[model samples]
Target: MKKKAIVLLGNKGKKYEYTRHNFGWLVGDLLSEKMDLFFRNEYTYSFAEKRIDEGFIYIVKPMTFMNLSGQPLKLFVKHKKIELENILVICDDVDLDFGRMKMRPFGGTGGHNGLASIVREVGTNQFPRLRLGIGRGKYGMVDHVLGTFSKPEKELLPSLLSKATDAIRDFFILDWQELMLKYNTKVSV
Candidate 1:
């Protein structure tokens, strides 16, 4: 089995927590808890790893913040000797409605700063990614992404995050194509 990396992208600090932009970290938090893993901090990021069967799953949270995620990610990949195909990035997307998600085996950044940094540093948009939607409401893109969840959204958030984590856990067991087919549809939560 190949060693795989799951990169959960988000900014650091309490100020960013619960904001729309921190969705990736939120998912990572839930995943860590579910897996009973603890992230060990490095200068650029924090990461937890678990060995399974003949492979390993590395969960990475970039502490370099969101925009500079690529620097730490690039270093991690090289250090772990993980192939690009084995890497999966998770992040928030503004295009899809809130609570909806989309996964791609490989694609462009789609205007995400963290993703763009990853693409630039990794030198390709050919890696797999799971995008959790944080839809743009009436507010400007900056405001909407930076703001915390609305009351209604907060009510529904736990289920959404749990589902996202489930999809992530599925990544290791199922083939990427099958996982996409199963998760890319309308997910009611």
Candidate 2:
């Protein structure tokens, strides 16, 4: 069977740009550039598709605001007939240190509203997820999530994003166990 996956971006518009919440979108932008796919707005989401040798990859940025991300996600999944295992939700995580990443086959929302929306829409948390860490700031959790990356964090983003893009590719090329062993950790940025 063809291996298919949907990569989700977490926020929308100028208001949320560069905020920690948009890290998933940033990663998707990088990958889209690398893959040479340009997104076009459709069905309340911005999306692009690329067909690689193995299967198809879909990159999605839900126009739905952060708290209601699941609407477009569920619509896309159902419209495309994609299985939960084939979907990989990418979002920012405050709990991890900046520049770190974690991948899990299934889990709870980890207190992220976007994730909670997804869990609610899907009716299960069995899908894979790529959690990109945007460490907390001095102000506190809310402030940190709402804030953009600092100068140092901005400097580190490309390398971290590169690693993340590679992880996504690895999900296609290698088995889950191998990919997890190779990539689930902090890497030098």
- Worst lDDT run of 10 residues, candidate 1, spans 168-177
Candidate 1: pairs in clash:
none
* Candidate 2 Cα errors over 4 Å, as ranges: 1-3
Alpha carbon RMSD to native, model 2? 1.4
Candidate 2 lDDT over 85-157, as tens digits, reads: 9888899988888988988889999898998988898898899989998877798888889888899998998
Model 1 error, position 58 (Å):
0.8
lDDT digits (tens) for residues 7-107 of candidate 1:
99988899989899999889998999999999999868899999988989999998987999999999999988999989889999999889789988899
